[model samples]
Target: MNPELAVLYAKLDIYGEALQTIKHESGAVCPNFMTCTCPPCRASYGSWALASEAIEKATKLSQSASQPEKPMSVCTKDEPD
Candidate 1:
């Protein structure tokens, strides 16, 4: 539920899940929650900083990490079935 957890998930390349967690959980505790649409929430990001290492790790994590693939539609042709 912590923003830090989202950060960790982001580092793991699970951005979608990380974001869902952030918006639904951590964002709830924020003063300016705005459904996690805020450029910067009322809460200072520094408050979530556990240490300089966490900040450094988060910074080092690449935004280009591969995201989970979306599920494909399942439609079977009569012949295929």
Candidate 2:
């Protein structure tokens, strides 16, 4: 229920729904303002890392599911010489 986590989730393309959930839970901007250099900022950075990891995993799963079993190939053995 951290605003920092919500912001990080929002920025992730694959986890936009997660971000929306966060926003619904916490109705406020992230505590770590651009100029913030406090513990909250560090926490936000950590949240961002977690969100990025989720995005990467989701992307891999999506790609794997959509990939074709057989790859396309072209033959040119008898083409122009």
Candidate 3:
């Protein structure tokens, strides 16, 4: 796997975990009853777009990575077999 792809996957995992944690916490409190001005919510909202973009990029990269590559020729036509 490519190093850049590895890094991107790690970042995606981190962001996904964070979003899950935030979702769980947010669900604990009803937003309709109270105006939640929590740091988690703020952070989650702020980074949501970035996380989504990361996921998109990672998905595309993984899809491309899964493709089979053509075998390299050991000798060119000009070279003696």
Candidate 4:
């Protein structure tokens, strides 16, 4: 969903649930990133218009982007053996 809407919803004090509904209904969560592909919410494209445009560009750049890549593993060097 448009992360911005999430913020608005946050300000309204209904971020998790209400914002989610609005985001979906508003077509903010670009279908390309709807199912399981989209980057993390923190990395979201912000507004619906921006997200939609980003999705389109990503699609044109790589047809396979429809299926987002597996998340990169966190650096293991910080962990003790």
Tell me the TM-score of each prediction against the true structure. 0.24, 0.43, 0.37, 0.24
List runs of model 3 lying over 4 Å from the truth.
Answer: 1-45, 70-81
Q: Which has the better lDDT: candidate 1, or candidate 2?
A: 2
lDDT of 1 at 13: 67
Task: Give lDDT tens digits, candidate 4, residues 1-81.
Answer: 899998876765543344455445554344454443456532443544454555556458667756688898888676677
Candidate 2 lDDT over residue span 1-81, tens digit each: 799988877666546667444434432235543346566765665565565666568779989999888866979689787
Q: For each predicted model, how many residue pairs clash, with residues at least 3 apart or on different chains? A: 0, 0, 0, 0
Candidate 3 positional error at 71, Å: 6.1
Backbone clash tally (model 3): 0
Best by lDDT: 3
In model 3, how large is the Cα lDDT of residue 70? 77
Compose the digit string of candidate 1's lDDT tens values, residues 1-81. Answer: 899998887776664445445544553346645445455653533333333335455556644355566799987867654
Quote the RMSD, in angstroms, for model 2. 11.2
lDDT of 3: 0.63
Q: By the lDDT metric, which is better: model 2 or model 4?
A: 2
Q: Where is model 2 more than 4 Å wrong at Cα?
A: 1-16, 20-37, 71-81
How much does candidate 1 score in TM-score?
0.24
- Against the true structure, candidate 3 reaches a TM-score of 0.37
**lDDT of candidate 1?**
0.52
Span of ten consecutive residues with least summed lDDT in model 2: 20-29
Ordering by lDDT: 3, 2, 4, 1
